[model samples]
Target: DLDEVINGALSVLALEARAKGLELRSEIDPKVCTGLCGDPGRLRQVLTNLLNNAVKFTEQGEVVLRILPQEETSSAVSLIDGISGSQAALRFEVKDTGIGLSEDARGRIFEAFNQADQSTTRRYGGTGLGLTISLQLVKMMHGKIGVESEPGKGSLFWFTARFEKHAAGKAALAKQKPLPLGRVLLADGNATDREILRAELTALGMRCTSAASGEEALQFLCGAIADEDPYALAMIDMQMPGMNGVELARTIKNDHLTKGTRV
Candidate 1:
């Protein structure tokens, strides 16, 4: 539901991006649970501002919006990080190959009615209220926004917001019709077992990738995490040649990157 809302928010400017010959795209992790408690309108406002800014500043290249569930130890550092047992942090990022910004502009980007320079407003045509409104919206969500840019290169604007995925959302997900679950990691030393599990998952509408050992599975998981599309589920044989199922599950649970996945 949240993802759908985000799509709607981005759609407001999609046509404009295309008209200017700019590519605008959004990606959400398959494992990101959709059921959440929050104001969709305010959430849209936050995303709208970021996307709006990304499109307005860029003359060429692409604008990408990425969403993923974040794992963190404290809400203080990133509110979208673990804020509570029943809640999870969802990170939103808007990256663009725009004109970029100066170090000084990055510092004051969130301030009300302030642009990187007076010339920015004259060239970009805005009152510089987008970031200011967005910052307040994020603050209301107990979240924070950040920016990284190098003049003439590109920029990455990111923020994190917490959401409570209630039991009802889980129930709804369980009731949803079968559909592809993005990527899955299959771990079993026995080639036969791995094939059988993979086939079953495939029939259930999933793309299963094989890992011969627990150590190998961890490597794949880590790589996938960096790519921001980690496995949604991991199937490991309880009895394997190396790094048995118990140990593998324990390792996955211990690591923040793969901890949220089903094992």
Candidate 2:
């Protein structure tokens, strides 16, 4: 169930990125598996916020989605790193090449409403509830969240959660229906989310792209149609710095550039 939920969260992010025309990549080790004694919906929500934040901030470059077997460490450090181990410890990481936070900001980044700076909040336009909510959920699920960033470079947000491998018979029997690869757009201020999403889309056999904001996503859509290759559908995030999802979708569906394109 947790794996399914994790796949769903990854799918959501991937679909969003494709809709925006951003490149996404993922490296989920097939050997790394886990089981969770947690609420799937809440877990998915927390994962969604972190992934969304990564995609929202990235203007260009790649985002990475990685799953490692490791335990949560501490908050005193600037970055979190770990090596492979015998006992299983599932870690979910979203790394992006976007506007990074200063050391001062990274300290309180997980706190509610606390971003890199006031200007970051204003320019990026997030409720700041994402990481806060994510932290709470991680703790509730017996996990930890950490952030590593360098100004003008990028950020890596990671969390560790417990998981156990599924048995072969049951694991083989359990399956999820394949998700269709439609035209999707992910609008965010982060690049990590975009890249991770892009990777997931490709894994699902869908074409994907990345955009930093709704404006960029619109521009991409317009350009796609201008190039005579439009999307079939779109999966957009409601929050963005410039134009919101509704406006962007309208611009694509109601305007000449993407009027023939699907939402």
The per-model lDDT (C-alpha) reads 0.81, 0.70
What is the alpha-carbon lDDT of model 2 when measured against the actual structure? 0.70
Compute each candidate's TM-score over C-alphas.
0.64, 0.55
User: What digit string (tens of lDDT, one per residue) describes model 1 on residues 127-182?
Assistant: 36888888889888777888989898888998888777868876776676656567
Q: Which lDDT tens digits does candidate 2 get at residues 45-78?
A: 8778887888888776766767764533344222
Task: Indicate which candidate wins on lDDT.
Answer: 1
Q: In model 1, what lDDT does residue 134 have?
A: 89
Error of 1 at 67 (Å): 0.9
How close to the true structure is residue 216 of candidate 1, measured as C-alpha lDDT?
93
